[model samples]
Target: MSKRGSGLFFAILLAFALILSACGNNNGGGNQGGGSEGGKSSGGGDNKTLSLLTGGTGGTYYPLGGSMAQIISDETDYNANAQSSGASAENMQALKNGEADIAFSQTDIAAYALNGELMFKDNKVDNVKAIGTLYPETVQIITTKGSGINSVEDLKGKSVSVGAPGSGVNANAQQILEIHGLSFDDIKAQSLSFDESTDGIQSGSIDAAFITAGTPTAAVESLSAQKEIRVIPIADDKIKQLIEKYPYYAEDTVPKGTYKIPEDVKTVAVKAMLVVRDDMPEDDVYAITKAIFENTDKITHAKGKLIKAETALDGIGDLPLHPGAEKYFSEKGVQK
Candidate 1:
């Protein structure tokens, strides 16, 4: 009885020890795996992935941002993925909140965010720094033929889409109106997206819209296809006034054939730009900026063609440039 019982007890103890050893090894492996996953997700590893915030799918920013992300991922050590967002104001907030590493924004909107003015009143976003200005976002005031809206003054008493609420477009519209001796109170203001504004015009619900985007905007192009649309020219005198008040604005012309209009339409424009979190490593930001400008030809969007190193600082205004971008631009002899 003693020999048999002793052997059985020894065997049971050995099996329990083996089980404990296996459990310890499994726990150690689980921790290492969790850490690796976290590093990849949080942009903390050698192959860091950055979140690049862009605009809605229908607009220029989303497509251009996607192209830029592809360039960054393909050419640099970092991986970037562009996520569709609410554009400028929201993108600035995302950067300030640490939810994004890069974003596409309008120059005027970036100025407003930095200064805590207009839509960003009393809540300045100080963490965003510019990569560079990309292209001009023309402020197109569109109306259908025979709407009797020939100028900014004629917009009085008519329904006009003033862009989405709290958007850069809205601010532009307000400023343009103010310069024209009008205010939102003078018109039936409607807050609508590009697609919604165009649809409103088609359905006769909106008399006109203030669309701030690159020339030959998709929404305006689509609207023109079904109905003859008119891009009302901002008078030269008013444009002068606009530029005087908002130094970020530049006079732009919508070429006659751009929308099949009878003549070139004068307008003002803000620039589209890239902004990055100020805390990004200088080397990483430098690589990102270099990748973008060096590879602009790879970008398939129409606006992408306009992205050149020479014009990178066209309308940056008072927003601070990321050290990385500044480094790249300085190396290229680009003056800020």
Candidate 2:
């Protein structure tokens, strides 16, 4: 062949090769056909990958998500990746954009997204599904005993960390203050996570900060051991209205011994749920949920979430439970 003809053939071959590679990555495993079968079951396969978007690496969500990945992998055939993200709100947005397959998010965020309320504004996140409620994220109010910060009202003029932008904790703190006629400008503000806020408290750069996490969070554990930190609970009557406007949240208590605090701390809280997009295959969702539930010991115990495997699915909303998860739950009689 002529040199020009040879060059033309080579160019065509390269283009075809690139197109083939792209198609191969997107459509997925030929094993998809054999995914769901008999009572014996098949947990998807090695080729199927699901993503779990979690909060800051220093926070509970990250470790919880990592533990989930491990437990699910051991119990199912699907490979999971627990990705570090900007927390609840960010994870919801990522879910809408298909950036992740599953995520750990606050109950308030899921409610707001589904209802198109508050931060959701015009864009409604209509496809969110809940697998289970992990545990309560207590809004921990830490203050220097000498800071004269006795209540949420006394936070005025005191340093506070609202948490990182786009995080669920920050959003909840914003709602709590606004309902009570306060604003970021009403107090000294610092954008930090539980760990960051703990560091600030240790160094005395801030007088108080809000933390939303399970009991005995490592950061709080360390801080409580050092400073004479107090757990100021959010037990205001206004919380009833907050919960009315958003039903996803409920009343929870930071028990007397959860921290070094001497008394039970009452607070408004929300469940942390593992969410998924609408399009994930039922078998895939079921297998993932099953793996996590069956290996609950691996996740909750590893991360110290203070929970049980079956307890996770206890309070799911009307949002259609993934069929696979439903199948498992139904068999276990958890959904009766």
Best by lDDT: 1
Worst 10-residue lDDT window for candidate 1 reads: 32-41
Task: Report lDDT (CA) for all predictions.
Answer: 0.87, 0.76
Q: Compose the digit string of candidate 2's lDDT tens values, residues 65-90.
A: 88888766565555678898888888
Off by over 4 Å in 1: 1-46
Clashing pairs in 2: 286-324, 286-325
TM-score, predicted candidate 1 vs. hidden true structure: 0.85
Please give, for residues 1-336, the per-residue lDDT of candidate 1 as tens digits: 699999999999999999999997666343321212112223323666889998866578887888998988887766789998878888999999999999999998998899888878977999989999999999999998889999899999999999777888889999999998999999999998888899999999999999888877877888888999999999989999999988889999999888778888889998999999999888778888888998999998998889999999978867899988898899999987
Question: Model 1: clashing residue pairs?
Answer: none
